[model samples]
Target: MNENASSDVKAKRQILIGLSGGLSALADRMRSQHAIATKITTLAARAEAIAQRSWDLNKLNSQDLQRTMDGFVGEIKTFAKQAIDAAVRAGSEALLGKEVAEAIAAHSAEIARLTREIDSLPDAAAVRAILQPLSVTLNTLPARLKANTAMLKDVDAIGALATGLAERGDALAAGGTAGNRVAVELSRDLRQFAEEATTFSLKMASEAALAVKAISDMAQRTLGLSQGNPVSDQAPSATDRLMTLARTGPQAGQVWATSVSRTSRSSPVQGTPPGVKW
Candidate 1:
């Protein structure tokens, strides 16, 4: 080949390498995004399941509080019934027939009214009313406190899950920037490749051009082969290249690209390496 044609071919070879690298980088970026998407999808499904089964914690619906109220109301009602009977009996012993009978009737009516009120008002206020006079420490207070603590913990767990989901969503959004970066770089590479291809075509048309290359030339160039070697005579075979990639790159938290490296696929090992895993 003439000097000019040789130089042109070398430049084209370098450009093709650049084009391959750009496309590989793009594929790597997409793979990373795919892994992230998979993780996010898994996490989202878990979050949704948890949300669907989340416990409803209403203060009024507390089992511990309800038990306490029921016990308080029962005790108070018993005490009131006893008090009314005693008052009516004492008044009967102190008064004449008509007055004593009227006192007993009035006491009975008041007792019935109190019982009806207690039965009708099934709320926290009624509980408080009965509990105030009793002045007794509730048996379920400790259990109720524990339940409240558990409820707070549930809230915190839900909040944490929500924050995680939000962060994952943000990461997915950020991947858009990565996608755009891949597009820009790939576009630049493909555009350069096209321009170089056109230049090669025009050069062939106008002048004593680069020699016509065989189909085998493309296979050789794609693997970066030259003079019966790739990179050097000591280069690993394709399978060895894959094995080396599996061995070396995975150790350092490398992700995205798992294929053998385009350059430096393996260092030339001299001795027979022990049974290598494919």
Candidate 2:
């Protein structure tokens, strides 16, 4: 009985040792599995963080791209506005130029018409008629004065003779005969003076005619010059027209510069990126 009991105790001791060994092995396996699970969890967390960072980076990149696109769009709009304004300005200038040219042309036509009317006046013909007779009379005046002087000299000689006779008569007491001789000499002198006065009148008339002719010539010449029909051969040239256009047209540089400045100021600025400095 004692032997059987000792044997049973030994068997129980062996069985306990085997169970402890099995438990220790099972604990080691559990520890290894726990370590693997911890590693896996850490790796998963890291991957999630990396993915989040990537998303953030993508968002930032997209925002930056949007901002850049907005800037580009703004610039494009500015260019378009400039182009449109330039076109409008050009059109306006063209219209202004045309209006100015038309106005100039109208004024020129009016001037030409007035000139023609003035030239067509009957003043020249009337002036010619007035001058021609006056010129003839002036040409004959000197001859008439010479003839009149000769007649006056004759009258003076007759008067001297008559005076001498009268003195002789007075000495002889013949008063009636002396008075008759003096009367005849006075009458001759009056006739000569009258002829000379008539000659002078003719000369005056001729001078008046010459004056009329001169005035007519001057008027015609002035009209011709005003109409650009210079007595000289020189005519207005293409350069003159160009100068006129320049004086009337808008300045090129000023128009362009103004348009550019206006377009720049009126254009919108680009949108800024989120959390980024302009």
Which predicted model would earn the best lDDT? 2
lDDT measured at residue 83 in model 2 versus the true structure, 0 to 100 = 29
Residue runs of model 1 more than 4 Å from their true location after superposition? 1-5, 52-278
Q: So what's the TM-score on candidate 1?
A: 0.22
Could you tell me the lDDT of residue 215 within candidate 1? 14
Off by over 4 Å in 2: 1-4, 59-278
Tens-digit lDDT track of model 2 for 142-215: 23212122222322332332233233323322223343343343334323323332232222223222222322
Residue pairs clashing, model 2? 131-209, 134-205, 134-206, 135-206
lDDT of each: 0.28, 0.30
Model 1 scores worst on lDDT over the 10 consecutive residues at 206-215
List RMSD in Å for every model shown: 46.8, 65.5
lDDT of 2 at 172: 24
In model 1, residue pairs whose N, Cα or C atoms come closer than 3 Å (at least 3 residues apart or on different chains), thus clashing, are none
lDDT of 1 by residue, 113-197 (tens): 3233432444434423433321211122112212122222222232232333333323323333343333233333323323322
Shift in Å, residue 79, candidate 1: 53
In candidate 1, residue 60 scores what lDDT?
28
